[model samples]
Target: MRIFDPHIHMTSRTTDDYGRMAAAGVRAVVEPAFWLGQPRTNPGSFTDYFDSLVGWEPFRAAQFGIRHFATIALNPKEANDPRCRPVLELIPRYLDKDSVVAVGEIGYDAMTPEEDEAFSVQLALAVEYELPALVHTPHRDKAQGVKRTLDVVRESGISSGRVVVDHLNEVTVGEVHDTGCWMGFSIYPDTKMSPPRMVEILRAHGLERVLVNSAADWGKSDPLLTRRTGEAMLEAGFSEDDVDRVLWRNPVEFYGQSGRLDLSETADTGPLFEGSSILRGGS
Candidate 1:
């Protein structure tokens, strides 16, 4: 059961984490630039974060035989801090870099006006670059957040096929699916959706144009979540084809549209590293 975790924050993980992910059958991952556990105080931090996402992280994944790719964006939670504007301004310069597949993990959090502003700006960037957009909906007021995300997508005019609405649970899944955009589920440990409930969503949604990920970061989360979800699906009586479609095919089809997912032509060797950490060079 080869899989592709369409969402993850590999920057927060270790090389041994990558090895465990590969051993668990993860073939590739799409890591979106997001808020670190702590708030970044300067634009320089954000620049370094983006640099690592495209540089060392891919090198580390390669070492474990897992292909690495990323989506670049200004996370919603950080949008409120006026200090983040300069970093947001720098997004366009790197949006088209080799491993960047989308402008993403950008949407609403707490449904704040600042989040809306940042989301709108990044959504336009995705349209301008003709790349797919991965949206992160709110954990609170989820229904309204999902609706607001859809409205922005429609207004951005980036085709629905190019937008992925992530972090959906049962409450908002139907609405996200109804919007004609790709649906994403993050199977987390205590918060967000769990593996048992994920199987229930799969049972209801039927695995078409859907993706599953760990969204694993510095917080308490598991990098092998995709495998656990797959295991749950198997226990729930899903066929291998069903598992492949949701876990592998859908994400590949979505990110492959970015023209960066060509693992076939690239060498299978894992990415390079610095010490135990994946090192993305300083700008």
Candidate 2:
């Protein structure tokens, strides 16, 4: 079955990973601008990161026949740093880029006041641009964090339906779902949520406006997580139609709102990275 991994960090992965994903049925992915697994010392780092997301990464994915898209934001974990302001300033300039589909991977991290400020500001930006948002809730006090995310969305005056509350688990899924926002599940290897538990969650909650992703990045995570989830769904007695809606159709329908969903056309774009090796007849 064709699949779309709505969340992943291709910048931290290799072209080989992309090739394997394409071979496994993943046709598209959305990579959000997030903390680089370390503190970025300057705003220029953020600028370069955003540039790669809009430029190099998309070019790289096209070669593997995987459609690439992104969301731009100042992540919550970086909000506490005084140097983050300049990076935040750069976000507005690129939000309108053709490949940028949302205004997030932004929301509370430690539930700090600084996180609140960044979250509110980005929400306003989403409202001004009329773009959907991808919100990341905190790992601790998660239920409260999800509630706070919903509160901020309502206060920003953007429709709740336009927000996707991500990284949800059983402890927080009901609150996220009840908030009228779309729900996203990240099927990480050993930390976030396991594939087996994710299947149970889907069985209990029933797929309505739900999305599943790998959220893979510069970490010990699996890049082919969507496929793993699909395999699990099939084993759990879920029909192909049900699995398709969660893995493929839901993300397309969500990110399609940005006017940037074009995976169907990218399959003809050729290998993920051309002329980079002897395989492509390079010098």
Winner by TM-score: 2
* Alpha-carbon RMSD, each predicted model: 3.7, 2.4
lDDT of each: 0.86, 0.86
lDDT of 1 by residue, 248-269 (tens): 8899899988877777733334
lDDT of 2 by residue, 1-283 (tens): 7788989999999878987887788778899999988898789989899999999898888776678999999999988898876777899999989889999989999988888889999999988887899999888888888888888888889888888999999888888777789999999989889889999999999988898999999999998888899889999999999988999889988988777666657553333434343234443
lDDT at position 159, candidate 2: 84
TM-scores for the candidates: 0.92, 0.94
- Summing lDDT over every window of 10 consecutive residues in candidate 1, give the lowest-scoring window: 274-283
Which residues of candidate 2, in runs, are more than 4 Å off?
268-283
User: After superposition, which runs of candidate 1 have C-alpha atoms over 4 Å from their true positions?
Assistant: 265-283
Cα RMSD (Å) between model 2 and the true structure?
2.4
Instruction: For model 1, give the RMSD to the true fold.
Output: 3.7
Give lDDT: candidate 2, residue 24. Answer: 80
Count the clashes in each prediction: 6, 4
